[model samples]
Target chain A: MSKQKAVLSEEQIKTRRGRSVALAVTLGVLVAMFYVITIVKLGPGIMDRPL
Target chain B: MTMLEQTQGLHEDATDLGGRGSVSDYIALLKPRVMSLVVFTAAVGLVMAPGNQHPILSFISILCIAIGGGASGALNMWWDADIDAVMSRTKKRPIPAGKITRQEAFAFGMVLSFGSVLTLGLVANWVAAGLLAFTIFFYVVIYTMWLKRSTPQNIVIGGAAGALPPMVGWAAVTGDVTLVSIALFMITFTWTPPHFWALALVKNGDYQAAGVPMLPVVAGETATRHQIVLYSLLLLPVGMAPYFLGFASVFYGVGSAVLGLVFLGYAIRVWRVREGDAAKKTAMSLFKFSLFYLMLIFAGLLAENMIGLV
Candidate 1:
């Protein structure tokens, strides 16, 4: 049987997989940053004891 | 003209009427139904959050999220024009129909994306801003480009993009990701497969012709039916998370459970029907009810918050 040829470079393969997860992580961080700042500002007011 | 030429002439004439790339058609490219769901969920998240926002800012925040969601939808449609042209279900979309050029769609999407992100960051908070930016990027780059053509698992993973709106709305209010907001995200994420698979069951031929590796095409009808049932089952408990978290009330709990059961029953019917016109009807019914189910769950939460019962 003929041997199978590998067509894509390892770098190319890595980039292909890296792009999706990287994008997800990058967005996750952006969302997380917004989350922290908003919490810091609104936390006190929301948790305040109502008169 | 020869017979072939006459047929070709008729085909061209048919395409002319079918290919209306008008201004109204371009707006329809934004997937308004999906955008409406994003807007509604984001609204519920904002209203449910504990802090009191100035009504104007709240409106601005929700509007920004809606615009950001629309921007993602536009970019998705723009990039997927080639694939859209191949799929009968999507062939009438603006870019695919030649109503809007790819470049024009790209520009519109980028402008809206940037404007929405910056505006939300300025008016609402950095958290909302960041979520907006990531959401745009996720849908455009990850879901539209990377996932759609590459895998049968596209909708499952890319469901995260659609689930971000409520989290963005929550961030707008609380400026932090909390258990409650994440739970809201999870509910949508879990519900997505069941909702989409129902539609996919009805549109299997379109997906097959388009060469998209949708679950129904890649996995076949039997697996698609089974997975729909499984996800609908999982969705039942997740739909009630807001009530358990004290972000909603008993009304929401009861409403969500009843809706979840109804959804599950439809999924079960779709699974049992299997094939033929009956199966198609079952899938179509599930598809319609799933939309109402999602809307009702969010509406129940909004009503609970309005009454100060959360």
Candidate 2:
């Protein structure tokens, strides 16, 4: 959540963008890891299903 | 945030006023440095186990163990924020520095604890998950809250939590612990006193002010140094246990012996040199070398396993 603040300077805006990018990248990597593990663990049974 | 702003924020937090923090602050609550060590030791246990484990399950199990370790750190920070604020070494922690609120830190830790434990149980076996749960409980409740300030032997007993990762990792793969894993646990368990007492000797003033009963604070520095030397002596054999047990090769055996000797030498320096500046320097030297000693021993085990595979 954004804190209440005055108008940002150019440097402040750049720093904010950097922080957001880092957070997004980290979360994305974690999500992708879980996704790969989920597919690898469960996909084979579903692929060979008869029902 | 600026220092002035952070100070104001901490003051507000102390008075039950409101403040805000960022994702990095939340992450810092997990103590990533300690988490890395836990993850490494746990991964070593899993990989070296002579049992089959699916790659996906092993990854998940290790990840869950790391998260559990991180959760313990967060819970520890939450409970010890008071002492942390007073201690120079820990005053800049996320909570005390006003980067995170106490309630938020505690909530974050609780969520991670339950999530990691339950997910590990579902993905791996209940045995591994149960060990993770116990490790967290031991670190948070048994070590951080109960024993930390109550007794001088706090780190001695609290070391169990730090030492559990390997057992958890081994159990994840084999679904049962073996003597090898127990030996790994013991190495870390005994290694704790010297590793921590070295730092305790340096930070006696902080422990004194925080009212934490560190061995140096309660037993005096000379006594603490004697204990460090004793523990270092014990560590020499324990460090070589993997090779002696035939799990690791002779390369590890030789490396561990040299490293253990160096470790003992540092502790001996701390014990023998009892002057003013010289004593502090030796204590700090032992403190720094202890980190390297632990890292190298574990790395030696990993390398031996890899060489065997080759």
Highest DockQ against the true fold, candidate: 2
DockQ of 2: 0.22
- Model 2, span B130-217: residue lDDT tens: 9999999999999999999899999999999999999999988888878999999998998999989988888888888777889988
lDDT of 1 by residue, B25-118 (tens): 5457567888899999999889877787767678778878988888888899877776677667877777656656666677778887997899
lDDT score, candidate 2: 0.85
Docking class of 2: incorrect
Chain A TM-scores for all candidates read: 0.55, 0.62
Writing each residue's lDDT as its tens digit, candidate 1 over A8-31 gives 667546544554565587579658
Location of the lowest summed lDDT over 10 successive residues in candidate 1 chain B: B3-12
Candidate 2 to truth, TM: 0.87
Which residue pairs in model 2 clash with each other? Answer: none
Candidates' DockQ values?
0.02, 0.22
Mark the regions of model 2 whose C-alpha exceeds 4 Å error after superposition.
A1-34, A48-51, B1-19
Interface Cα root-mean-square deviation for all models: 13.3, 4.3
Highest-scoring model, lDDT: 2
